[model samples]
Target: MPGPPRSRVSCAKCGEGVNDRREVISVLEKKLCRPCAAGGYYEPI
Candidate 1:
């Protein structure tokens, strides 16, 4: 059996194209890259 399909999504803030779907983080209903996700620049609601 196979897992979910791997798709590329662009980061909301940096606009960087995320190659791995797992690496993308969801914030404020938006998808972000690892740096944008782990970085302290964005505030949690």
Candidate 2:
């Protein structure tokens, strides 16, 4: 068996991989990552 091909969507702000499909695109900027969009400045991982 195989899995679906990964979709490549770069972060609007950082130009990095979002890693997941964002159902709704942010309008403040372009496509922003979860953290960027959420404004999570320093959330402990």
Candidate 3:
């Protein structure tokens, strides 16, 4: 048997789609991704 379906969540700040529930951050009743929650800073690659 298969498990329940996974719900897709998006970040309120950057509107980025978050695939994993563990990576979602809830702030002020809004869902935010890791980068957005961390002030949206992307390190140079």
Candidate 4:
């Protein structure tokens, strides 16, 4: 099945499109996918 189109802005960590997804991670004032912000290894804040 085809996903909901593709967008330019994607999550830096996850690589998923941050297009239609409302609940995106706005890190550094930028947009990111849910998984990118929530999952993955952590370094520091």
Per-residue error (Å), model 1, residue 15: 0.7
Error of 2 at 34 (Å): 0.7
All candidates in order of lDDT, best leading:
1, 3, 2, 4
Worst 10 residues of 4 by lDDT: 18-27
lDDT of 2 at 18: 61
- Per-residue lDDT of model 4, residues 1-45, tens digit only: 267645457666557665655446564776777666676566558
lDDT of 4 at 42: 60
Q: Local distance difference test, per candidate?
A: 0.73, 0.67, 0.70, 0.61
In candidate 2, what are the lDDT values of residues 1-45, reduced to their tens digit?
157536658887777676547523687647877777777678667
TM-score for candidate 4, residues paired by index:
0.41
- The candidate scoring highest on TM-score is 3
The prediction achieving the highest lDDT against the true structure is 1
lDDT score for candidate 1 against the true structure:
0.73
Which residue ranges in model 1 land beyond 4 Å of their true spot?
1-5, 40-45
Q: Which ten residues in a row have the lowest lDDT in candidate 1?
A: 19-28
Assess the local accuracy of residue 27 in candidate 1 as a C-alpha lDDT between 0 and 100.
53
Candidate 2 similarity to native, TM-score? 0.56
Residue pairs whose backbone atoms clash in candidate 2: none
